[model samples]
Target: MKVSIKHLFAAVTLFASSTVLADVLADIKPLQDRWAEVNYALPEDDREKAFAELLANADKVVGGNPDKAEALIWRGIIKSSYANAKGGLGALSVAEGSKADLEQALKLDPTALQGSAYTSLGVLYSKVPGWPIGFGDNKKAKELLLKALEQNPQGIDPNYFYADYLAGKRDWAEALRYLEIAKAAQPRPGRESADAGRQQEIAALLAKVQKKLKK
Candidate 1:
């Protein structure tokens, strides 16, 4: 079979793009896994240092693939986690950077990584102090989180985050429902450690909601 030179070049270009994308995603996986470990298993005092190291690596990933929304989403996730770990006035700068990364990711591809930008942004808005303190807004958090749910209704992160939002609002019944959905969420392929760690969080939160119900 004879192939035209133009067709051959196009094929090579497509393959190269695909390969690079795959490699980028692969590089991000361990960073995510380490993040789950640091967030859930590391001692409180150790979290900041661990996240700082991970953030540097995440910055490289984002810098290497500025056009890839997937990379941007992970960058935002790492920044947000790091900000949470490194609280106080110093943390706001990191959180703002995270918010920018997420916003850019959303603008590039809202559907990337099953809508994780929305989830991360939602959590940020929900947790950060509002107004004179910071940019947090419960209303914006609800909007973003629900948008994330619309994109990935069955996703563990979406359900878990929404449940947390509801709990913060003191809407116990709705929070419990979402928590149950999160508990029953199917494990993500190749992310067993993260799933397991998140499930532990779900169980702890579930227990809290149940205790609240009894009150």
Candidate 2:
């Protein structure tokens, strides 16, 4: 049996690409773990410092793999989480940086990590103040969140963030539906901590939506 030169070359290229992807995932796993730890396990008063430290490590990862969408996505996540922890006007700058990182990740690969860039960016758009104060736009947030749901219908982050958006819009019924789906999402391997933390958030939101419906 003889393999054509073109076929051999293609195989080699595919293998190299796969290897690079594996390396990127391996490198970002630590970032992901630490983020969940800082965001969930740490006390609220302590999280800002922890997240700031994590952001430094995330910066190194993004710098090392500037083209890896996964790395950029994680960096963006860390930045946004740090901003949330910091709070107030001072945090807006970090949030803007987070938006930029997520945008870059989208350009590199919109579907990387199950469209996480879209989910995270959508959350930013939904949460931030609009116009003079910030770039938030509910319309853009819905569009991005819907795209993320299309890409990852059953993903925990997509459903959870979309539900949060819907809740913000006072669409209680729709929010409840998505929160239910998010609550029941299958846990991701090697992301047990994140899954657990997100489940807690989902439960809290679910209670809020359910109470709103009863009101």
Candidate 3:
């Protein structure tokens, strides 16, 4: 078989891409696991240090695959989580970096990880302060979360985040509705830790909403 130079170059490019993608996935898996552990299981006092370690690892992943949206998404997720753990004026600086990473990820691939960039960005917009203090916009939060739901209508994350947002807006009935949907969400195979943690959150929020209804 006589392989032309163009065909050989194409084959090499495809193979390299696949290999790099595999490497990126491999790198991210452990980072994800550690992040879940730090966020959900570690004591609140210890979480800052643990998240800092994850941030370093996540940075390496992003550095290795600067153009890969998956890397950027994970980096954003880790940075945001780290910010939440830190929780102060300084935390906002970290969150701002996270926001940039997520926006870039959306630009690179809106559908990566089933629109996780949208889901994460939605969470950020909903939680951060609005206007002069920060860039949080409840309206934009709803829009981004709705886009996430359009991509993964039955996804636990989009449902739960949206529910949280509604609860913040004092829409108890709608919030409870989505919380129930999140409670009934099917678990992800390799994301057991995250799923379990989120379920705990869903249950707590569900209880709070129920209490609110009774008031």
Candidate 4:
């Protein structure tokens, strides 16, 4: 079979692009793994310190790959997780940084990491104090979470975060529905630790939502 020169060039370009993407993922995998470890396995009292260290690594990754959406998304996730561990007013700045990272990731590639930027940013909007304090907005939170779900219909993180948002809104039935879906999500390869941790969260939320429904 004879291939046209145009077709040959296009094939080579496609292969190069795929190789670069694979290398990017490889570079970011450590950040993702450490994040899950710190967020899920560390003791509460120790998590803040661990997350702080992880944030340094994440910053380096983002710095090295400024244009890689996956790197930015993982950095955002780490910052947000660090904020959660830090808690209180002291964490607000870190949260804001997280929001910025995720927003940039969205601009670069909204669908990267299965729309994780939307999921994480939606959770931030839902959890942060609103008005004079932070940029929290329930309306915007729901919009972003819904978009995340649209991108990752069977994703554990998206479903769980959206369910948490619904529960906050006192929408018990809807929260339960999403929680169930989250609980049944397929295990993500190379993410067993994260999947396990998320499953536990889903179980706890499921129980709470079910109790609310019974009331």
Q: Summarize candidate 2's per-residue lDDT along 91-144 as a digit string, tens digits.
A: 999999999999999999998999999999999999888999999999999999
lDDT of 1: 0.93
Please report, in order, the local distance difference test score of every candidate based on alpha carbons.
Answer: 0.93, 0.95, 0.92, 0.92
- TM-scores of the models, in the given order? 0.91, 0.98, 0.90, 0.97
Q: How accurate locally is residue 78 in candidate 2, as Cα lDDT from 0 to 100?
A: 95
Maximum-lDDT candidate? 2
lDDT of 2: 0.95
Candidate 1 has a TM-score of 0.91
Question: Compared with the true structure, what per-residue lDDT tens digits does model 3 show for residues 1-215?
Answer: 99999999999999998897788788789988898899899999999888888899898889888998889999999999999989978899998999999999999989988999999999999888888988889999999999999999888999999999999989999999999888888888789999999999999999999999999
Off by over 4 Å in 2: none
Task: Kindly report which residue stretches of model 4 are placed more than 4 angstroms away from their true locations once superposed.
Answer: none
Model 2 alpha-carbon miss at residue 155, Å? 0.5
Q: Could you tell me which residue pairs clash in candidate 1?
A: none
Model 3: how far residue 46 lies from native, Å = 0.8
Model 3 misplaced regions, further than 4 Å: 1-21
Models sorted by TM-score, best on top: 2, 4, 1, 3
